[model samples]
Target: MEQVAVIGAGSWGTALAMVLANNQHNVNVWSHREDQVNEINHHHTNSKYLPDVKLPSNLVANADIQEAVENAKAILLVVPTKAIREVCRKLRPFINTNQTLIHASKGIEPETHKRISEMIEDELGEGVHDQLVVLSGPSHAEEVALKQPTTVTVSSYHLKSAEIAQDLFMNEHFRVYTNEDVVGVEIGGALKNIIALGAGISDGLGYGDNAKAALITRGLAEIARLGTQLNANPLTFAGLTGVGDLIVTCTSQHSRNWRAGNMLGRGYVLQDVLDQMGMVVEGVRTTKAAYQLSQKLNIPMPITEGLYELLFDEKDPKHVVDDLMNRGKTKELEDLSSFL
Candidate 1:
């Protein structure tokens, strides 16, 4: 069995550690919180994150970052987007070019508009870039921790690394697919959170499924628009990380982004919603990054723009909806036609 290190103990990180453990990999999870470490080691449960789940007994938690990656064959970075740089810097001294580096976290860096892979590469250098892989799709931590059937895509600049990641996580219940389009995969994965927040806001406003359906569909177009501009394969947006992820994150109760958006829609302030949720809403930060990127790149992202205004500029959720509905008209497939 391979030894794996998961460098975060949040819900997603804990869930992934369980996956590795269940696959018979010796998995060590590192968390900054000692209390969380103690809980995982002694009780085998991360109550705060996965309240109803029992983590695999083989899954171990480490408070020490160095101890966690001591001899891991692969390392999975599952921290929030904002924490990625710090985590990578902490991991730098412990990591080598030999170990495969994979990140499951989604969201672009607000300052750099960089994907998680780029941020990791920046901190860890090009040696890690060659081995870097991204795990993304519609899979949720809640469902995956319960050993539910979940399929996800792993992508990398190097095909062999992607295949290695595929072998590392593939199992009866956790199916893995490999793709070479890292750009598409990362972009699709990150941008979907923004749309999910919009979807949540739409739902929170009690606009119903009809509004959500429109937001999701149009949101994919917006995502593809920016993704293609970044040199990603357009078809990738139609796959699991694209439409599939958008649909799941936007609709599922398990999505923190959606939940946060719902609260915002229901008339709660941004900080209050975040405080109440007690989790990092990646979408809020991502919305800012995306809004900035769209402005700089001159790409049109109406829903994202609306959400950004709602989250950051304190625009009324209903007014944001009105603004979206009042946007200039264009052919539905205008964006796709260029790609075709």
Candidate 2:
């Protein structure tokens, strides 16, 4: 059995740790909070994150960063996007080039506009990029922790590295697939959160399924536009990380982004909604980064712009929806050319 370290004690990280332990890997979960570490070690449950889920007995928790990565064969970086750089810097001192680094967190860095893999490379040096892999799809942490059947995709520039990651995470209950389009996978995973927020807002506004179905469909188009502009494979968007991830995140109550957007449509301010949610709504930050990226790349993303206005400028949600409804006509396949 290989020793694997899962950085972060959040739901996703914990659920993934469970998967690793289930595979008979010696999984060490690192949490910043001492109480959480104790709870996982003694109680075998992370009440703050996965309350009802029982963690595997072999799974251990640590408060020390060095001990977490020490002698580990693979490191799963599952922290939030905002914390990715800081965590990478701290983790760099312990990580070696031999170990595989797989990141499941999704978001484009706001100012640098770097993808998570790029951010890891920037912080840890380019030598780590070849070993970097991304795992993403429609699977939710809640469902995965319950051992529900879930599927995800792992992508990297190196097919061999991607395959190694595929072997590490795949199990009977959890199925894994490999792809070479790192850009497309990351872009699809990150941007889908923005659409999830819109989905929640649509439902919150009581606009019914028609409005939401439109938002989801058009949302995929703009996502493809910007992703293709970045040289991501357009066909990747048609796979699990693309349409599959979008469908689950935008429609499920388990989505934090959707819940946050729902509150916005229910007339709550951004600050209040964030305060109540007490977790990082990646879409809120991703929306800003994606909006700026679209402007910089000259990509037309009306839905992103609308959400940006509603989120940052305090534009009324109803008015934003109205504007989206009345936008100028265009061909449905306008963005499809980018793929060709």
Candidate 3:
């Protein structure tokens, strides 16, 4: 049994800790909130995040970040994108060269347009760990906590490191696959949240399945466009982290980004929606980053642009949809052919 440390105690982090514990790993979860740590240790519950789910009894919680990573064989960083730098800085002092560092959080860093792995590397620097791996796909934390069947991909610059992460997280209910397309995997995982918010807005605007279907399909096209510009394997968008993640995040009620978008579509103001969710809606930040990146790269991301205008420009959602529909038409296959 290997000792693992999960660096965040949010829903995703807690659920992942349960997965590690179930796999018979000695898992230590670190949370800044003392109350959350106490609740996890004494009651084996993280009610605020995973409301009805009980965490694995073997999964321990730690308030001290140093204590959590002290002897860990692997460390999984699952905090929000905004907190990644802070967490990585905190972890740098304790991280040893032997431990593998993996991150499951998704979202591009606004302004910098850096992926989670890039941000981690910037903060932790070189030679701090065996490898920097990213864990991403369609799996939801709530369902994973219930031991439902889920599959995800792990990617790293090093194939061996990806394989190592795959071995660490794979199980009967939780299957893990390894991919070497770190650029594709990270880009797909991050951009899908932008599409998901659009999906939520579509549904909230009382539009039927037709609108959402168009959003999801064209959204994939937009994602592939930006991804390829960044040198990602075009085929990766067809895989789990790309299409699979987009479908789940865009359609499911479990998605915080979608939920926040729904609130926005239902006429709630941006600040109000954020206040109500009480969680970092990664898509909100991702949309801004993606919008800026698309402009910088001269890539066309209509859906993302629309969402950016709606979220930040205070434009009406229906008007944004109208703007999207009114755009000049182009041959769909013409775009698909470029990826080939």
| Overall lDDT per candidate, in order of appearance | 0.91, 0.94, 0.92
Candidate 1 or 3, higher lDDT?
3
For 1-340, candidate 1 gives per-residue lDDT tens digits of 9999999999899888888899999999999999999998899899999997888877998989999999999999999999999988999999988899999999998868998899998999977778999999998899999999999999999999999999989999999999899999999999999999988888888888889999998899989999999999998998999998998999998999899888888899999999999989998888899899999999988888988888888989999899889988788776565256
Model 3 per-residue lDDT tens digits across residues 183-230: 899999999999999998888899999999999999999999999888
- Which of the two, 2 or 3, has more lDDT? 2
lDDT of 2 at 245: 98
Give TM per candidate: 0.98, 0.99, 0.98
Strongest candidate by lDDT: 2
| TM-score of candidate 2 against the unseen true structure | 0.99
Off by over 4 Å in 2: none
Model 3 whole-model lDDT (C-alpha atoms):
0.92
Q: Would you list the clashing residue pairs of candidate 2? A: none
Query: How much is the lDDT of residue 252 in candidate 2?
Result: 94
Clashes of 1: 0
